[model samples]
Structures are given as structure tokens and as C-alpha cells.
Target: MNSTGKESRHVNIHIASPVEEVYSYASDPANLPEWALGLGGSIENVDGQWVAESSSMGRVVVTFSPENDLGVLDHDVTLPSGETVHNPVRVIADGAGSDVVFTLRRRPGMSDSDFRRDADMVAADLARLKALTEPGQGPR
Candidate 1:
């Protein structure tokens, strides 16, 4: 479901996999580069924090939700300029499959077009996650 609200919007995708399987892969910050293209191309650990080199944001650190059995995959990305953005993600069971939801919050002073672009990027990322976690399928 997509919604326009006081502060945020969301993009979600359904995957043909169990919730545990989907959560296991998506919860790992090291795997962010494999799916979250808008974030960066690579992720590394530096001083116990995950860092990535973003072409747009330069070098940055990311703080991911702690390891847990629940399907929460929220995280925070701290930009080189010290600005941090919160990303709320969840993987929930849908009958026999799973649904991955990503919440994209609109930053202050962001234009409409840029917010739309961010949503588009998140949709693409979810598609990538679906392809990655679904059985009997190959990534596009």
C-alpha cells in the first residue's frame, strides 16, 4: 500500500518466500548494497558501524536495527554531512509468502519530484529483494 501523509510514504512488495527467509536476508546490513542501489554499491564495517560510499552523499555510516527474531528491518543512514534519515522496514507473513514494506520519509525542503524519485528507487529496491529471495527465480 502507498500513502501520502503528514511526514512519510511507503512502498512495498510481495515475495514468494517464508517470512523467516525474507527477514534473514533483508535484515543484514551487509546485504544492503545487493538490493538498495540508491544507498550505495558496497558496504563495510568500520569501528563496529557499517559504512558505505555513496556517490551522492559521499562516505556515510549506517545503523541497523538490532538482531531479533521479529521481522523488523528498520535502519538509519547518517550522511557525510551528519544528517540522519530513518528508514522503517518490515517483513511480514502473508499467508504462505512474505511482504516487505519500506517506509520513505520526506525530508524537510524536499521537492515533490525528488520524493517521487525516492519512492521509485525504493520500489526498484523491493523488486530486487523479491527477485533475490524468491525461489525458482533469478534476479532481473
Candidate 2:
């Protein structure tokens, strides 16, 4: 939740893959561009800070949670306007596969349509992740 105290919308997708495989791929900030198209088209490390060339917001710095054994993929995106948004994401073991969840927060003063658009974007990203992680689907 931000300072406005609004609850975030939860978007999730289940992939037919091992938790380790999903976590290993999604937890890496470098691979975000491949799946998280809403954030940016591409990402790179600049001066030790992760940066992405976002078509929506131009070049911006992105920071992800430290690499850990846990399936935490939370990240903070800093826009060029100096505002930061916290994105909470996680991949959990689900039987023989994995369940990936992402919390989509509505920015303060965002319109209803914009909020819906954000949710749609998250759904698409998760679908992309699912495709990229499924067996025999993603790059080998």
C-alpha cells in the first residue's frame, strides 16, 4: 500500500513448471524485459543500478529485491518524475508446478480506466511469464 492506503489488486497465473525454474527466471531483474512488457521494452545495468528504457516513461532506474532463496520478486520502479511505485511479486510452489502472483497498485488519482489498464497489463505479463517458463516453450 502507498501513502493513500489503497489495497492493491492481485493478479496471478499458474505455470506448468517447477517452482525453482519459475523463481530462477522471474527473480532475475535482467529477465524482466522479456516478460514484463508493461514496465519497459528492455532493461540494462548502468553504473551498478538496473535501468530500463521505458517507452511510457523514458529511461528510469529499477531496483529489485535482493537475490534470496525465497521466491520474493518485489521491485521498486523509479520514474523520471521522481515518483516510485512498489510492485510486489512472488512465485510459489503449487503441487508439481508454480503459482506466480503480482500485486498491481493503483496510483493516487488514477482513473478507473487507467486502473483497469494496469491490471490488464499485469495479466499479460504473467501470461508471458507462464509461456516463457513452461516446458518446451521458452528459449532453451
Candidate 3:
């Protein structure tokens, strides 16, 4: 588990491969868009696309990691409020698989209901990522 001062959330999964494989798959931004949103939560919709810098809301930076052979996704996103947040996503070898960690330092000032909804949304997204990064798996 990862517990950093203000921003660390640990999400671990026992993948069936080495850490390198998991890392390689996650570094690509294009490949990443597939797992960006989970089943119910969408980063885009019929009315708007999350990739757009500006949707109905003010301009939001749709930033992502630059593609690299190594599976390191250290991307920072800035909300419309001018709050630049670093989404620390790290992958480490754990036993026969990899342990993935994602963290957000300060609270986004979201409501309690929003928290629960976001948690479920992220949890589902992580599951989708696990399946996508593993070998012999298709887009989630």
C-alpha cells in the first residue's frame, strides 16, 4: 500500500507477467485512451469529448504522458481552476506481477457523493487497465 502525505492511493493487482510488460503497455497515450474511462463513467459523451481542451466547462488540459518504451506514465493534468495536479502512476514488480499506484495530492473539492462516484469510476478504470495491459487481452 502507498500512503504519501497528501496524495498517494495504492491500487494493486497480481498480473500474470513481469513488471516490464506492464510498464511497456501503459506508457503509450494512444493505448491509454482505451482505459481512460470505465464502464459507467465516461470522459466523453455524445455531447462532448474529454480529449477536447474545452468542453461545456472551461478549458481543461487533456494532458498525458509522452510515449516511451518503458511503461512509465508520469503525466500532470491541470483542472480549469488552474490547479496543476500530478497523477503519480508508478509500476513496481510485486511477486509474479506488478503493483500499480496512483495518487492525487489535494482533494479536488468534490462532494461526498462525487467521491463515491469517482472512486467507483476509477476502480473500474483500473480493472480495465489491468486487463488491457496483460498479455492476450484486448481493449477493455
Candidate 4:
């Protein structure tokens, strides 16, 4: 999602995988770089919360947990200037998979660069998880 306060971007994707499996992977701090490599443009997370402190894109941390079957990520992230923002990212199981919706709320004066990057990364992560959860087929 991208926004300038008056307007923002909203990106949504539906992943074809069990909610539990996706949640497990998405919730794990270790798997972040695997899907969202540009989060820090190379600077890795070394914080106790597994947040990136040296990356130009700042740290994107996890704060919400799916309801075992329905994943909701209500995350709080800090900006470069010590400002905090809210991310209401929700993943709901649909049929044999799950649908994700992520919303980023901030004042209008902020740039959407990070929001766009974060949304794209999240979508990629879901895609990777979908591949991992596919049955009768192995990860390639």
C-alpha cells in the first residue's frame, strides 16, 4: 500500500494455501529475508525483536498473529525519525486457502515508498508460502 495521507495505496492478494501453514511461515522472523530481501536492501535484522535497524527501508516487524486459521497482522513499525505507524494486515482462510488484506495508515505528508515495498514483499512471501504448502508437489 502507498499513501500520501490524502491518498494511499492498498494492495491485496489471495494465496492458495492452508492458513496455518502460511501463518507459521509468515509469523517466523527468520523467514522474512527469504521473501522480503529488499526490506533493508541488505542490512539484516539483528535486533532482539528481529527488526532491521541498519536498513535504509527501516525495520518491518511482526505484531499480529492469525487465529490459527485466520491470520491478522496488526503491526506497529517505527520510522527513521522515531515515528510509529499502524499496519492492519489481515489474512482470512477462503476455501482451501487464504486471502490477505493489508492497510497502512499514516499522515498525508509521508512518502509511500516503504509502503509499496512492504506490500510487494508481503505478497511475495505469501506466494512462496503457497508453493511450500502445495501437496503432491515438493519445493523446487
TM-score of each: 0.92, 0.93, 0.65, 0.65
Give one digit per residue, the lDDT tens place, for model 3 in 1-140. 12233433454456666777777776644455467552122233224323423332344454566655454667665667777656666777887788776653435455555445545655666677788877676642
The prediction achieving the highest lDDT against the true structure is: 2
- Itemize residue pairs with steric clashes in candidate 2: none
Sort by lDDT, best first: what order? Answer: 2, 1, 4, 3
Clashes of each: 0, 0, 1, 5
lDDT of 2 by residue, 1-140 (tens): 24463857999999989899999998887788899999899998888999999887788889989887778999999999999999999898999999998988888877777788889989999999988999987773
Q: Which stretches of candidate 1 lie over 4 Å from their true place?
A: 1-5
lDDT (0-100) at residue 129 of candidate 1? Answer: 89
Off by over 4 Å in 4: 1-8, 41-47, 53-55, 58-69, 111-140
Distance (Å) between predicted and true CA of 42, model 4? Answer: 6.8
Which number leads on TM-score?
2
Off by over 4 Å in 2: 1-5
lDDT of 1 by residue, 1-140 (tens): 22343468879999989999899988888788998888888999988999998887789888999988779999899998799988999998999999998999988777788889889999998998888889976652
In order, what is each prediction's RMSD in angstroms? 3.4, 2.3, 6.1, 4.3
lDDT (tens digit, per residue) of candidate 4 on 1-140? 33446554565666777767666666665665555454433323455544654355455553334335448655566666766666676767889977767664546555567556556765665565556555543452
Error of 1 at 39 (Å): 0.9
Candidate 3 segments whose C-alpha is farther than 4 A from its true place: 1-8, 38-59, 62-72, 106-108
lDDT of 3: 0.57
